[model samples]
Target: MGRSFTVYVAVLAATGSFLFGYDSGVMTDVIESPNFLAYFQTTQTSAIVGAINSTFSGGAVIGSLQGGLTMDRFGRKKTIQMGALICLIGAVLQSAAQNLAMILTGRILAGGAVGLMSMSVPVYQAEVAHPRSRGLIVGLAQQMIGIGFIVSTWIGYGSLHAPETSQLQWRLPLAFQVVPALVLVIGMIFLPESPRYLIEEEQYGEAMRVLRKLHFDGTNDEWIEAEFFEIRRTIEAEKSVAVQGWAPMFTVPQWRTRMLHGVAVQVFTQMTGINVIGYYQTIMYKALGFTGNRNTLVAGLYNCVGPIANFIFVVFLLDRVGRRRPMLFGTLGISLALICEAALNSQNPDGQRIGYSIGGVFFLFAVSVIFSMSFGPCSWVYMAEVMPMQIRGKGNAFAVGVGNWAVSTLWNQVSPIALGQIEWRFYFVFVAWNLCVSFPVIYFLFPETKQKTLEEIDLLFAQRIERIPDEMTQREKEEAGVSAMNVENTKLHN
Candidate 1:
């Protein structure tokens, strides 16, 4: 029963991610329909279209920041439930939108909800999971995001292809997002609060109960107690060093440094133009070579590939290769692939050659796979792991929020314009964005987070370890009555 309960909660919480993907990807099919656009002319409709598309992204940024603060105050379950309600509202508005403004309003509300779910779900999973399984559990949210993308793309494709009388096509698909949001709200109502949250509130007994519930194997209660104590101690250690609000996060050297890395990784991931691929693949496929259902089929295939790649990489290699290396390799590889596509597209300036266009689109699909296995899922897992718990919620929210806004501003708006005007240069922009910023961010800002406990990662910034020790060697320092390397190193040598 305990194990079932835990699994159920994880599955239910994952629905929020599905809604995020659905809303983002649905537009790909919707945008192509002449009926949909005939209602809104170019003169008055462009701003509303941008507003509708960008609203969710903008809301996600705000929601992410608010989610962090709210998760601390109102438990994870409630935060997600609120998100579900917001998604329901957004879905309804989108399905029934008479004007572009109502659609934008709906997207804003839905986006904010997804923002909260993104932060709260991983935090809850991390707090409840065993130390050995922590990476896997927290990584579940990443995997689910991929799954959400796949499902949304296929559904959108099928819906778009249904008979002309089938209002069920787009309308039903958009409405379909509401069902998952509804499930999340109901399931979360009975879920337990994170043990860490309970402990923070000084309710040790309840925290223990939640711990026992999560770990059903009758694992030693002593281990749980020790973990609790360690958590408390770490929180205390962080109190002196942890920055509060924008001042410390933006101004303090160490926090600002880490925050920059957080921000950069997210930006790189976005500029990889992955979401643009997810949301615009159908259009891109049609533009390049494929048409009608063939394009939709290819788009669906591309969507399916991303999550599968993510599952394999995250499940098998994440802990092995660590965070920074994968990110470096992924961004570089994606950049090169995009460069190839850019060159190909540039050669065929008119976008008329079917063979060349198809080849370029295939290369783009390949790039998506590279991103999926490397940056797509791994980046979020790394971001969640790197920030200190003290300001993790807020710091990540702010960093990711900025990235989301960048995505919404660039990918959402620029994509249509780029496709309409400078098609070849579109790929160039993404290629340059990745090559220029990706390496510097990984080299200087991002820290190694392989095999280290979350508690240990937090200490890196608090102690300001100019030179970070490998996780294996870091343990040796703990044996000498210290976690950091300063005084403990001399004592160990003696």
Candidate 2:
């Protein structure tokens, strides 16, 4: 068991992310269903519709915060199982909803479930992954998200064929969320707990066993021993200074900086206006002159573009290109696309021009393509990898909960009204944010963490360096006949 095993566990854990994507994406088409709106007796821009979207995000905020504690107390694997179970319950309620109250309640529960998994999955992946492939492993969270979006959009598009009054159009998609939730719940039973967590719990034997299975390549016993020694030393050092329960996140200067980076990346990800398009792409398509099933059809096709780009980035570019440059490039590209979309929308305010509609759609796809390659996956990757083990669960939760879900709730609530009343002008808000705020922050503050181990990242942020001990270096040299410089380099690379 080596890289293959790690990938297997990461993929299984990402089913939680898949549920998050499905739950979030399913509503894009659900609210667009004519029967759904008529049955609820509400229009797409209605406050009730906004509440439906906002409530899920609101629940997610609470869930993310709660999940941080849950993962810390019970471990990453159990937290994921708990989230999946909650999602399953929510999916059942949503599929059987008879009124707005019922549906909103279900969405709230589902949102909580997604929030829980969103915080847990990436942290789990980062903890288990070899540093050489951590970006790829952690980035799987976003790739699975893109896949979830694809599946939901296509299902939503297919549901358009149902009889006009059939509630199945939305109900079936809502129900479909249950399948992945069930898969995630069961899959965790076979997965291992994070070795770092085991070490923190003082289960040294179990931790060593896990490290061996995760990193062993038959002739790397010395390397395995060296890594175990480093992890134990770092964790012990952290334990000596670790404050109780979230205080250090705010009180410690280095931890505070880490928190800022985590929250800022997530907040900026939302500010990119990706969800504004994702959660309401059908509505945007409608405003662009698409009618009936055409809205869902175009949305289905549009949803496909992001995942393909994201997959390529995660596998080939993420580690090679690192995090900062891609984020800068992505934000710049998104700004340009948004500008183009705004001009197109402004030119075709009446929604009568085909060329403008085509341009508007093209720019929308451009935004997705750029975002997928840059911020979409990188945000999650950066947030998960940046924190110390002690604060990782709660710190990540705060960032995702406050930065991602809280901001998302605001946007999800206001976007329908904004798009309806202001139209093209709404695009400028994100453009300004991208150029004035997001770009400058990444350029000035963010440091490269690619190809660095979790412990090394700790040193990087703490403004200190922790070299491998001379004794350990000599031991490795004697045991494996590896040079001290070669051993140090391997440690840094991993």
For each candidate in turn, the TM-score is 0.87, 0.94
> What's model 2's overall lDDT?
0.89
Best by TM-score: 2
Residue 51 error, candidate 2, Å: 0.4
Winning candidate number (lDDT): 2
**Angstrom error at residue 157, model 1:** 1.9
* lDDT at 429, model 1: 81
- Lowest lDDT sum, 10 consecutive residues, model 1, at 485-494
Q: Give the poorly placed runs of model 1, Cα more than 4 Å off.
A: 1-8, 42-48, 163-166, 240-246, 349-352, 462-494
**Each candidate's root-mean-square deviation in Å?**
6.4, 3.5
Tens digits of per-residue lDDT, candidate 2, 407-449, equal: 9999999999998899889999999999999999999999888
What shift in Å separates residue 444 of candidate 1 from its native position after superposition?
3.3
